[model samples]
Target: MDEKIVFKPIGYIKSPFEDVKNMPKSTRESMDVEAEMIINEEYLESMSSMEVGEEYMVLFHFHKSEGFKQRVPFMGNGPIKGLFSTHAPNRPNPIGVSTIRITEINGNVIKFNGVDMLNGTPVLDIKDIL
Candidate 1:
């Protein structure tokens, strides 16, 4: 039988971006944006080996996105296409992944840049990418 897998959020992400419409479509060259991750107390120990100026892959869930359509209009374009092909927030799982630059680290909060998620988003995991 296939094994079952379960997961829980390790923390929550905070950002000035309160709405999806206000966020940019991409974070490639956007350096002015900023965000923070308020990690849970239980996961504090795991951060000991981490350091400043390192990058991490933040996996999070878009809790506010309720439903999804198979085909969505692309950036107000003409026809609808598969949701997976676009970065639309509406999805079956609504999981978002973004690589951000670590600006600073407090006791349980991490400040970073290149944020595409809205405030209050639950962070599933944080992995060192560099």
Candidate 2:
């Protein structure tokens, strides 16, 4: 029997980026953007004991990228490569993962930096990187 799995976002990501075209042309090191993780009420309790000045791995869904391209040109390099081999947003499962530095934490909201996701993206999970 074929089985299917589904997932619901535990939170939402808020950022200054409104469109994917405006995302930084470079990776994490070159971007100094700020963003926030507004977690759902049900997951608030799980954030307890998380300290300030820490980092976490954020997994999120790129709801905007719907079509998949078999090959695309690399961002910096000018050669076309398979979608899976490059970090192009288009994919079967457009999930984005990034490690960000926690700037502050207030209640269910986590303020952070080094954000690369578009505004209102659904966050799948957050893992402490201690």
Candidate 3:
């Protein structure tokens, strides 16, 4: 059977990485790269319960990635591995998740770190890690 699922973005990211090539290679590299998640006005209430200093998983879409291969080099140039084994952006669903700690919340904007996604990435959802 074939089915379709649709999702609406609750927000978008504001990060220094305007291009994928300029993004950090790993989470360790992006830990200090501050970013912001600007929640849409309609979703502003969703942030009411989120607290600064708490960590949450941010699910987003890789808007620029177009396709994927089952097997590919690790980190662009390494031993080949299955797509599910690596963190490549190109995938069957082009969805991404990153864990970030909330540093500040002003209105509907959340300032955080641990960003590894490109600027303007559409945020699908946010969830508490616990």
Model 3, range 23-80, lDDT digits (tens) per residue?
9866668878799999998888878899999999999999999989999898778999
lDDT for 80 (candidate 1): 85
- Which candidate's TM-score is highest? 3
Candidate 3 residue 7 Cα shift, in angstroms, is 1.1
Residue 111 alpha-carbon offset, candidate 2, angstroms: 0.3
Model 1 lDDT per residue over 30-112, tens place = 45687899999999999887777887888989789889998998743547888878777788778888888888999999999
Report the CA-based lDDT of candidate 3 relative to the real structure. 0.90
Give a tens-digit lDDT track for model 2, residues 7-125: 89999988888977777644374246778899998998899977777878888887888788888888635699887777777787787778888888999999888788889989998
Say which candidate scores most in lDDT. Answer: 3
The TM-score ranking, best first, is: 3, 2, 1
The list of candidate 1 runs beyond 4 A from truth reads 1-6, 74-80
Candidate 1: clashing residue pairs, number: 0
Q: What Cα-based lDDT does every candidate model obtain?
A: 0.82, 0.81, 0.90
Which residue pairs collide, candidate 2? none
After superposition, the stretches of candidate 3 with alpha carbons farther than 4 Å from their true spots are: none
After superposition, the stretches of candidate 2 with alpha carbons farther than 4 Å from their true spots are 25-31
Cα misplacement distance, residue 50 of candidate 2 (Å) = 2.3
lDDT (C-alpha) at residue 94 in model 1? 84
